[model samples]
Target: MRRVTVQYFDGCPNWKVLDERLRDLAGEHDLAIDHRRVETPEEAERVGFRGSPTLLIDDVDPFATGDEPVGLACRVYLTDDGPQGSPTVEQLRAVLA
Candidate 1:
């Protein structure tokens, strides 16, 4: 089974949406979803959390650009249309695939 972790801060509203989308994707892939809530900046730094709704596949953030500022804040994903709070389903599917 593939291990997936979604690290997020409580302040971000998009976390739940990301979680739900990931759950759907996991269901299709027969993967288990692990949700981790990072409540502090220290914890975020300890876990290398980039921002809210960070998806980690096998302990690696596949979508991370490595240049994102590490802190407690909302994350923006660049999509074909524009910047989105949460990545589109197609983006998620492509990453998971």
Candidate 2:
């Protein structure tokens, strides 16, 4: 099963959206979701956290552009639907698949 780590901070409501999408896609794909709540800037830097709702597939953020500022902040995804708080279910499904 693919291990997906959802790294987020409590301040951002966007993470919940990603969580829901992941839960929806879980059954369709062979994967497990691990939620990590980051509580500090030091911890964020330590773990390479780009922003809240960062989806780390096998310990890597496939959506990251490598230029996002670290710390507790809302991450926006540039989907075909345009920029959004979280990636669409279809986007998540493609990565999981």
Candidate 3:
């Protein structure tokens, strides 16, 4: 089974977008989804949270380039469809596969 942790602050709506995609993929992918709310700057730093809606798969962020600074902010993903608030279903499948 794969563990997927979604870390986000309340202000960002993008997390919900990812949440739906994860839900759609969870059954087939054997994913155990965990939602974490990073409430403060210190907590964000402690958790190495790059931004809201950051997906940590097996404790590693597969989507990260190691260039994003830790913070409480909305994250944008560069998708085949162009920049998006969340990754597409196809993209999520590729990762979860």
Candidate 4:
């Protein structure tokens, strides 16, 4: 089974959207998602959290590059449309596919 995790900090507005989208995808794909709350900077570093609402596929961050500074910050996803706070459903679909 694929281990999909959504990492986020508290009070992040974007996480809910990602969570909802993930729930929809999970229903379609019959996969389970782990919602992980990253509470501190040390924990974020230990867990490789780049930002809030990060998606980890099998504990690897598919959306992360090697250079992003890690901390409790809102994340931006690059899409064909533009940089957005949350990734579009199609973008997530491509990744989940």
Candidate 5:
């Protein structure tokens, strides 16, 4: 089975939305989801966490570039509409697909 991990800080409001979308995506793919919450910069660095609502597929961050900052902060996704906190359902589906 493929593993999906969503790492987020407590302050991020978009994690729930991401979680819901991921759940739906996982259901479609018959995959299980794993959620991780990171509270400190040390933990973030240790996990290579880029920001709140960071989605990892099999431990690989699909949206991250090697130069992206890693820490406890808000994450932005480049959606068709514009940069947003949470990725759209279509975007999520594309990633999971």
Candidate 6:
């Protein structure tokens, strides 16, 4: 089965948005999703977390461009509504599809 892992830190407001969308999509696809909290800089470095609410599909970050600085910060996605904390449902659908 494909694995979807969402990496986020505590108190990140945007994680919930992505989490809910992911859960809904996972249900539709019969996939599994995992939520991981990056609590420290060390863990972030070890896991190569680009930012809070980082989504990994089968251990690979599909949204990353290979230049994002790894840290415990809020990640932004460029959408039709301008920059947002989480990707749009359509965008997520394209990536997850």
Query: Which candidate gets the maximum TM-score versus the true structure?
Result: 3
Q: What TM-scores do the predictions have?
A: 0.93, 0.94, 0.95, 0.90, 0.91, 0.92
Q: What is the lDDT of residue 49 in candidate 2?
A: 88
Against the correct fold, how does model 6 do in TM-score? 0.92
Per-residue error for 87 in candidate 1, Å, reads 1.4
Off by over 4 Å in 6: none
lDDT of 3 by residue, 29-95 (tens): 9889999999999998898999989998989888999898998989999998899988889989888
lDDT by residue (1-97, candidate 6, tens digit) is 6788889999688999999988778766666889999999999999899997899988999899988899889999889999989988888888877
Best by lDDT: 3
Give candidate 3 misplaced runs (Cα > 4 Å). Answer: none
Model 1 misplacement above 4 A: none
Tell me which residue pairs clash in candidate 2.
none
Report the lDDT tens digits of candidate 1 across residue range 1-97.
7878888888998888888898888777777889899999998888888898888889988878888988898888898989888888899888788
Off by over 4 Å in 2: none
The full ranking of all candidates by lDDT, starting with the best, is 3, 2, 6, 1, 5, 4
- Candidate 4: Cα lDDT at 94: 81
Listed per candidate, the RMSD to the true structure in angstroms reads 1.0, 0.9, 0.8, 1.3, 1.2, 1.1
- Candidate 3 lDDT score at position 5: 94
lDDT of 2 by residue, 1-97 (tens): 8899999999999999999999988888877899999999999999888898999998889898888998878889999979999999988877777
lDDT of every predicted structure (CA atoms):
0.86, 0.90, 0.91, 0.85, 0.85, 0.88
lDDT of 3 at 23: 94
lDDT of 5 by residue, 24-59 (tens): 777687767888999889998998888879988888
- Clashes (N, CA, C under 3 Å) per candidate: 0, 0, 0, 0, 0, 0
How far off is residue 65 in model 6, in Å?
Answer: 0.5
In model 4, the runs with Cα more than 4 Å from the true position are none
For model 5, where is the 10-residue window of minimal lDDT? Answer: 23-32
